[model samples]
Target: MTMYWRAISEDQPGPKWAGLFAEYWPAYLKWWLKEGDEVRASYRESQRMLKRHMPEMLPLYDQLCELAGGGDQAARFLSFYCPPPYLSGCSQALWPGKAPVLVRNYDYNPAAFDSLILRTGWMGRKVMGTSDGLWGLVDGMNDAGLAISLTFGGRRVVGEGFGVPLILRYVLQTCTTTEEAGQVLSRVPTHMSYNVTVVDRNRKYLTAMMAPDRATLITHAAVATNHQENVEWISHARFTATVERERYLLHRMSLHRDTEEKFISNFLKPPLYSTAFSYGFGTLYTAIYRPRKKQMEIRWPGTTWPLSLDSFEEGARQVNLPGAA
Candidate 1:
């Protein structure tokens, strides 16, 4: 399944609207119920944390409830906090805001995948219903020269704190530089497991933060799969495979001593999926976000579709849309 979408806002202030919960509630509800009470409790805790860190998100939550048709189940699901676990195949290229792009090889179904792209805001809030259930992203960008991608890190004992989705949103909203983004992460309490990758305007800095019980900065040139540096924790069989695949890729890339551009290009190559050696359900799609050039591009490898990107800039762009702001 190869697909991508582009959203550009000249006067719209970074997508503060709420329509995703309404759009994918049925899928979300189905997955939420599967998790039972433990997941439900965690979601409630996530809601409380969201209210404290980003009160502005409350309206969106309320909107999601209304969209879910307003009932105890909807309320309960809305209150839950866990982000759907994703097997993301991503590559980043730097054009310094002008040419930043991200390519994503998403693992879920195509229909559900399209819904997520449409519902996500540039700088607002987004919730996606996936095979593993619901997940959130704060902001995502793709321009001429920069791109950013994030994925969850699941471990046994990361105590509850702010939901990873909110943190993703915060990064999209406030920071432009890797340094600035790192600073924001430093201040937050990341109680869950996550790996956030940032590719700046120049495409020179590619950094990952593996936040388990606490956030740890990773300086390695490349990271794949799940385990963080020096941390020992057993994960599910599927995740273990995913991590192993990443390690293999990282090692293979290291052998070449490639530049960032070459590294990303190599990483984006289509996976070979077979019953014996699966590439984790085949990557659904890939997207690139460029900051400096204020543009974004997306491609679908399976279908060989055209790459797409949307552009944006500072003072010239409106911070809020007509009624949504």
Candidate 2:
């Protein structure tokens, strides 16, 4: 199946939202129902918390429910309020000094690679990012010069909390700085372990290590990968190289050669960018967020698409990942 990318903008919520979500509704339903009772219970708990704390999101959820046929199944599908599954091999780093930029490689299941879509809409700030099931964002940038991205925090634990995507969405909608985003992240609950890397217009950055059971760990680091101080999920096949990937990024950053072209050249290569197609991570696309410029660039090997707050356009490109069929 060919993946489609569409952009929509609205001043106030309306029926037009349905078409944006309907494209992936079937596949979303199939993935959502495949889970067992335990996962369903977790989703219910997440919904309750979201209702209480993040009431601003309720109306949007209502719109999605009504659009998805207005029932229990539709609500569950729109909620997307379950624990996040483990994904590996994401490397995020901040360019030092003025005019800071954030570059990230989103690696995940090949099946979801084709389902990817980038959403840019008006909220508190002009926001744009890519999502899989269409409920929340995977990575995005807001007009306030804040850029946020996620990676599996390298742990094997699940609890009652919202998925990282929604938390990220909340940050993009509400916060304007790295400190404010960190506070929001600390207060909100998450279903599983994850690391969120946030950079702001002021050149400040933070990597939040978040899980349901513990307090959020805010680290001021230039680079983040699948693991933290040490590799926790070393036994898992996907994270065997977590430490190596982390080291590669840090070593490169340590050289003080902070040129954009150098980093892009390296990130587009092996280890930093995954090509595995068997069962683990595969690099779908590289996203570069320029906080000062208020712009974003989606880069594949040969082609690139640029977007900004003042103007936007919907586009799609067909290309093959390095080692895929």
Candidate 3:
């Protein structure tokens, strides 16, 4: 699989951003569009969400539509407010350091790499993370020294709420602290289940378990995998090892207790860094978000790509993962 990268500065004029959108729109559409009324209905519902709750981002959404020459339809699709796939495999931890940080390992279908994009954008403060197609981010960090990531909340339910990725985009774009971001996550209606981990500049961190039917549950427990406490999605067990994975994270955090080093290294190995590629939950990359320096790093076995707010790069490399065969 091949990964792609793109960078656009906020200082760039609207037209410049439009040009970049134009360049990638076709590829995005080809990969994301599905043939069904359910998909269309979801996009329509997402449009309503933008109009009512997140009107501020409308201008950017409209610009992308104009760039794609798809008018209103493009904006709705890009909103990504549709139902998301049942993704799994993530272990999030609030790393205890001189400056606490957020660490995550995102595992999911390898086919997703076809639409994978690593975006670094500067809108006053730099924002960098991986994006799925032209939609919002799956994980990212801001220059304000704040970072946020998500894991599937291991539930097989879908309802009337926005996709978690768009919500993540909103939080990163507007909130500067863990408390503020937590507030957004609590209020936003997510269509499915998710566990969002947020870490701010002050070393404050939170994990929010969000589902469409229930009020968001905030926890001081710094680690989250594919399930919430006491609520496991029994049916999806084949695809998610939620119980074992969560325990693995908890045990390691307890053992490492005081430093970031021990746990991070451990995450790169079995259980935390998954090898279950055949189940479509392969650990693609482990992301380390360091807000103090406004930097982030993506690591795979034997290789690391380090990035910072001041200097960002756009490139890609194929990764060799366990069970790739």
Question: Whole-model Cα lDDT per candidate?
Answer: 0.45, 0.72, 0.72
Tens-place lDDT digits, model 1, residues 164-215: 5556555655555667666666656565655666666765455565564565
Q: Tell me which of candidates 2 and 3 scores higher on TM-score.
A: 2
lDDT by residue (tens digit), candidate 3, 154-257: 88778877778878877887789999998988888888889999988888989999998899999877888888877566766545667777787777666657
Please give the lDDT score for candidate 3. Answer: 0.72
How close is every model to the real structure, measured as TM-score? 0.64, 0.91, 0.88
The sequence of per-residue lDDT tens digits that candidate 2 reaches over residues 1-325 is: 2234445554344555566667667766666667654456443654687787677787767766777677676676566566336455677777654668888887776665433445455354577776645657878888888999888788888876777887888888888999999998888888888889999988889999988788889998878777765566777524446677777887787766768867866678778788776655577778888888878877767767787755766655665667765
- Displacement of the residue 150 alpha carbon in candidate 3, Å: 0.2
In model 3, pairs of residues that clash are: none
Per-residue error at 37 for model 2, in Å? 5.5
TM-score head-to-head 1 vs 3, winner:
3
